[model samples]
Target chain A: MWHDRAMSTTGRRVGRPRAERRPDSGLSAREELLAAAAELFTVQGYAATSTRAVAERSGMRQASMYHYFGGKEDLLAVLLEGTVRPSLDLARGLLAAEGSAEARLWQLCRSDVVLLCGGPHNLGALYLLPEVRTERFAGFARMRRELKEAYGRLLADAACCTALDAGEVAVRTDLVFGLIEGVILIHRSDPDRPVEAFAAATADAALRVAGAREEDLAEVRARAAKLAQG
Target chain B: MWHDRAMSTTGRRVGRPRAERRPDSGLSAREELLAAAAELFTVQGYAATSTRAVAERSGMRQASMYHYFGGKEDLLAVLLEGTVRPSLDLARGLLAAEGSAEARLWQLCRSDVVLLCGGPHNLGALYLLPEVRTERFAGFARMRRELKEAYGRLLADAACCTALDAGEVAVRTDLVFGLIEGVILIHRSDPDRPVEAFAAATADAALRVAGAREEDLAEVRARAAKLAQG
Candidate 1:
């Protein structure tokens, strides 16, 4: 079935590809459409991007574009989900695992930053789009909220964060989570920067924000290194 | 005198205000135009916002709107600068004043966050708008660049951060600065959030990211408190 047919850098497909005049991205049509949308939305303002433009840029017929996504909003929704789903999955696993809270938190942050900055486009930056606040994007919003709460959980449980009361924990979570999300803006300015190092530094900064002590960080770093290897 | 006119929550004005039907923002014509543009561009979006619409929303005649700003891009440029100028001014003062780097850094971070989060609208959020990357906003971009360098200088000079090499200092600066810019998004989500407490927590988190130790923070906090009152 078309739905089960795997595509690289994209999700499910619905209908047959347009046989003629498609972009030779080697990606499936759906993937090409998303790639086109990502570039247009990020480079130009989203409101200025038309479905016809996305279709044209992807080198497919406009009608065929609907086979992949309902319209511009659908394309945006998938792009957003692609950015968050990986981080959320990792966060879920980190929550269920046995490592120290500091290690797990650090791992989640490093991994999440890597995923966020890893996209072909700086998709994480799109989170600031005003259209994202609407009810239509609520699924993406819910997933992000769960991901944030997971960060809060890992942070609150960290041994180093124990001195913080509930209010302090919430505030730190806000800052740590903000730092993670915000790094994308900085990252986008210099997209060629090495991701692994950037991710590691961002995670370290996050730990500091969570009140992790310096002497304790070496142990947490070692444990987090193991988590990365595993 | 119009050029020297300093309107509250805004900046210099231009040619005579429209004789009739301007927005009762108690602001000068230029300030009113900015207020309207800030609201519409963020709520709706920049691409979707027309200069005429901003003019209409500001309660000014379309023909006379040009008497103030050159166009939509001019309106945007002013709004962007308004967000950064106060923070930049504060950073300059903090850099010149005597204190532990930790305390000055903390004070700058807190006060900057307040200015950022304290905006009539979340004007800082507009920094991500793609139009900002264009050459037209170069002045605002330069100011922001200088502001970031100020952050790096403060971070690199901190005693606790002494062990960090130059590269690590750069990375920490990115994360801390990212945390600061990124907080506007979080602050917008919970617009009712108390700014002072939020600013303090964010500043503390920023210091941690800069590698300030817990023991050092108490004195830094005291010194920062004095800076606040001074």
Candidate 2:
């Protein structure tokens, strides 16, 4: 009976062959949709972008778009999730890893700067959109808070390793995030700079903002190398 | 002949008495309009705010509002001018003043941080609105560039004194601005922090980002005191 049922299912199935399944651009349908949405949302403000426009840009029928996202807000939620979640995971991993707080913080900053500079458009810039501040995008805000808290913890740890006080640690954490986010604005104004150089400079600035002592820097750099190796 | 004409006009024309001319709030209609527009634009946004809404908020009819400003864009331009022009003037003043680059840079950062933190809504945050990036605000962009260039020069001078290379100086200048703008973001997240403390911390972080030496900070602080006296 089981064999008969399995045989019947094989005969009735009408799936596209594996060779024809992938799109010419090689992005999955969901990824293509996200890529299209990110482009439109970045170039044109999210309020002006429509589901139909996203579908058209993705080379899919408007009807098929619904299969991927519930609506426009969902599309944005997904796009932000794609950008924020990985960083959050990495931050959590770094926080747990064995290394000096300075090294861990440096690694986080370097990786984050790379991510901010990696994309064609800095997706982190989307956080500045007024629409993202509304209740509809509360999920994005929550994830952002988690990322910020991660920064706060790393900063506090770094402060402990250094001689910085609690009050200053709180302030420095915010400034460090700002310094990282500032790279996006700089990139927007002058996109010609090499990303690697920008990332390295931003990472070094972040350490400096945390009040890293000159003597500890050599040790931090050594630890940073080991952290990178992992 | 001029005195005779003025006397005749004063005697014949029914001008409101000086006391009657000024409003109970002691603001002219134009000033009242600007104050109202800043509040509305900061709470809502530029595109979402309407001229009629601004007029209503200002306790004037739409027609009367038009007498002060041509339209909503003009209202925003005036508000931005009020914010940006003063900072630009201060930057120019600092650039012209005689002092070590560190002292001049410190003073600019301290004063700018105060301005960014002084407002009820951190008005500098308005610069991040996507609508503000459009052609209508090219004047603001130009002023911002002048401000950034001032920062670049000061940083380069500091780097020269510190023995940092040209590439490092370029990187630090962008990070310094980022550190300052980060104050606005920090204020938004935790509005309870004392503005004085935030300003102090930001100025210190900025100097650190520029690679200020421990031995030189005391001299910079002394010059900052002298600069503040004026």
Per model, how many backbone clashes are there? 0, 0
Q: Identify the runs in model 2 with alpha carbons over 4 angstroms from their true place.
A: A1-22, A61-63, A159-161, A215-219, B1-25, B159-161, B214-219
Q: i-RMS values of the candidates, in order?
A: 1.0, 2.2
Error of 2 at B180 (Å): 1.1
Question: Model 2, residue A72: displacement in angstroms?
Answer: 2.7
- Chain B TM for prediction 1: 0.90
TM-score of 2: 0.84
Q: Which lDDT tens digits does candidate 1 get at residues A87-202?
A: 99999999999969999999999988899888678887678788999998999999999999999999889998898899889988888889988878788778999999888888
Candidate 2 lDDT score relative to the true structure: 0.74
Give the alpha-carbon lDDT of every model.
0.85, 0.74
TM-score of each: 0.92, 0.84
